[model samples]
Structures are given as C-alpha cells and as structure tokens.
Target: MWRESSNIGRNQTSSYYVDNTLKHSFSNKTTAKQKSNDLKMPQPDEPYYCSQQIQIPPALPDILKQFTKAAIRTQPKDVLGWSAAYFRALANGETPPVKERLEMPVATQKTDTGLTPGLLRILNKQLGPRKTVDLNIIEEKWKDLALPKEQFDELVRIGGFGGTIEWLRYFALGCSALGENITDAMKTVCEILTADPDGGPSRIPFPLFKDLYTYLAKVDGEISQEHINEVTSHLQYYVDKQEGYVQPRNFTSPDCPKLS
Candidate 1:
C-alpha cells in the first residue's frame, strides 16, 4: 500500500509541472499578440518624426521673391560678393549698381556711308575748335527728327560734341525708315554744303545746312509738307521761294543763296 501511494504522488507532481509550463507559454504568446495589435499606424497627412525636429517658415514677400528669381536666372559668379555689395548699398541708403542692359545683335549688313571717321573729323572741325558745344543748339537743329523728348534730353545730357555725330546717325536711320537711301543723300548733301565760294572745300554754316536738309527731306517726300510748314512756322523769319524751296533769314548770307 505504501509503495503504491508514493508512485501516485510522483505522477501527480509530474502532471502539475507539465501543466504550469504549458500555461506560462500560452500567456506569453497572448501578451505578445496583444502588444502587436495595440500599436498605432501613422496617418497619411502627418509628417514622419524621427529623432530630429525641422522648422519650416511661411512664403516670402512678392518683391523679395521676384528679386530672388531674377538672381537665380542671372547666376552671378560671386554670389557672396554680390550679397555683400547689395547689403552695403542698402545700409548706406543708396541704389545698388546693376549690370548694363544687353542689346540683341543686329545681323544687317552695313553699307559704307560718307559719315566715316574722316568726315566726322571735318564736321567736328567745322563746329569750331571747342571740345563741346551748347547742347541747346544741337537739340534745336535736330528737333524735326521727332525722337522721343525724354530720350533726346538724356542723350544731350550725356553726350557732349559726340552727340552731334549720334544725331546724324539717328537721322540716317530715320531716313532709312522712309525708304530713302540716306548714305547717298548724305554724300550729296555734304558735297553741296562743303562747296566753297572760291571753289574749295569750305566750312558749311550749320544753320544753312539745317535749312537745306529740311528742304531736301521735304522735296524727296520723306517728310510731309505739313511737317515743313510746322517747322518753318516755329522759326522767327522764313521765306518760301518756290515749290519745295524755303529760306530761313538767319541762314541766308551774301555769298549763300537766299533759297537753300
């Protein structure tokens, strides 16, 4: 009887140990599964957060944005130097220096005109020995060219005696627009104006040359008769000699014809 009771107790202890082990394992598996399901997934709109914090600012102002875009487009070589100069100018309450405006290259073939450097030298000599002349005189002479008033003023402000040469160039361009061959006309006009009293190349009187040029443009139908009338009306004294001929008293001398 004692041997049988001992065997039964041993069997019960073994069964208890096996049941405890299985229960513990099941509990652990259940806990792990619960943890996996409880964990939350992130929404699409939310930004991912790692260890670091990032700060984003609002949009920039329109003017500042435009300037930044322009700078990016230009792509200057020395960005830091440009920034320094820009800041310095701003601190000094002055405008920063900007790059010059680039003009598109014209591909038209250039025809040789008598307005060469040699002719320019002669014209300059005729204007007198002075390096500069009254800007008003040039402005008055070419007023009929009909360039923008502001642009003409700016040119006069910047260009000294050199402005006269620029005016002639501009006049040639204007005449070209009217279907007139300005180079040939300029050659003829210069020859006529420089013709001398004693049969030598002489200094042309500026006022007389201006009057003759105005007449020539009108006669060639480059400018309207109404335009000529308007110009003559502005003069203090003018005489109409015949059709397509006019004389300004100040330009007429004893030697030069009254009608130019």
Candidate 2:
C-alpha cells in the first residue's frame, strides 16, 4: 500500500514538471517573437521613404542671392518695359521692334546678350519676323556663342520678366541645346539653392522650363498659336513681375529634370 502511494506521488510530480516545462517553453518563444517584432518596427517620427527635412539644394548663382539688392539698386521700370515689350510681341505673334542697338561694353558684349544684331537676325530668320520672340531660341543658341554663362546672365537680366523660375527655364533650354555638360550648370544652381535655403530673390528657372518643354516637345507637329498663347499666359504672370521671374507652379513635376 505504501509502495503504491509512493508510485502515485511520483507520477503526480512528474506530470506537474512536464506541464510546467511546456508552459515555460511557450512563454519564452512568445517573448522572443514580440521582441523581434519591436526591433523591426519603425519609429513613429521616422520617414518611411525619404525624410521631409531632406531638401533639394537651390540650383542657382550668387547673382541671384543679391537679386533683390541688385533689383533695388537698378531701375526696375526699364527692366519691366523690356519684359513687357517681349511679352507683348510674343502675345501678338509679331516681330519685336528692333530697339536702337547699343554696343555692349567689351566685357559684357563677350556674352551673347540676345540683344546683338547677329542674334536678332538669327531670331528673325528662324522664328519669322515677330516683335515678341519665343524665349527658347536663346537656349538653342547658348552653346554656339562660346560664352553661354555670360549670355545666360544677360538673358536672365532681360528675358521672361525677371523671375528665378524664368531664368532657370531659359538656362535649361540653353543646357539642352548644349547637351549633358549643361547639367553641371544645373548642379551649380542646386548648390546655390542648397546653400541659401531662404526663397531668396535668385530664381530657379530650369525646373519650370523642363516642364514647359516636355509638354511642348510632345506635340505631334508644330506647336499651334493656341499652344503659344496658353504657355505665354502661364508664363506672363511671372514675366510681368520682372521680365524674368518664373512661376512656382511650373516646377511641380518630378520628371522635369529628365525632359531635356
């Protein structure tokens, strides 16, 4: 009887130990899984794809940095008149009147100012005799002139109504005509923008131009006058502000850089 009691007691103890061991194993596995899951989870504040704080540097020049000061220092009315004249010519599809050509000082003349008689002749020959010209031609000719940067600076000062957006667009056009080396200029602008985070007066123009060019380039054939008007109307808002200011809406595309 005592032996029977001992056997029964031993069996009970063995059964309890087995059950406790299984419970412990399951609890340990569940704890490990939960810890692994916690490690894999992302923090609430972290960005899933790219950080919002990561900014694309401004792709522009030092001249743009002092744009307000440069603008304030110079006579805006003269600049506005120049942009208006070009805008009006573009709007009317008329030949821009040849203003009395002034010889740029030798230092400035080395750059293609788009105001030169040779450039004017090229403009008339290609675009037909119109008072307002398509600004894209400036891009087409930048490389052939041998001094694109200087010429681009002149175009920025004179064309598109004085916006960073317009100047960048015009610059992009020039870069496209010149080919990939143009990207170096674009990177320069990006560097400038990155350095100066403030929406400084120096405008970024390529982003908008690429957008316009892509839409314009995709047309099956010649761009119709209607198309010209639509583009001009959109561009005018910025141009009217300064013969060169480019609109922000023009740069709202990720594919703009590839448009060239």
Best by TM-score: 1
> Clash pairs of candidate 1?
none
Instruction: Kindly list the per-residue Cα lDDT of model 2 for residues 95-210, writing each as its tens digit.
Output: 54332232243232333343333333334333432334445554343333233356566545533334223333443333333223333333333323322344544454544443
C-alpha TM-score for every candidate: 0.21, 0.20
lDDT of candidate 1 over 1-48, digit per residue (tens): 899999999999999999999999999999999898788574589777
User: Any runs in candidate 1 off by more than 4 Å, and if so which?
Assistant: 40-260
Candidate topping lDDT: 2
Backbone clash count for every predicted candidate, in the order shown: 0, 36
lDDT value for model 2 = 0.44
- Against the true structure, candidate 2 reaches a TM-score of 0.20
RMSD of each: 19.0, 23.1
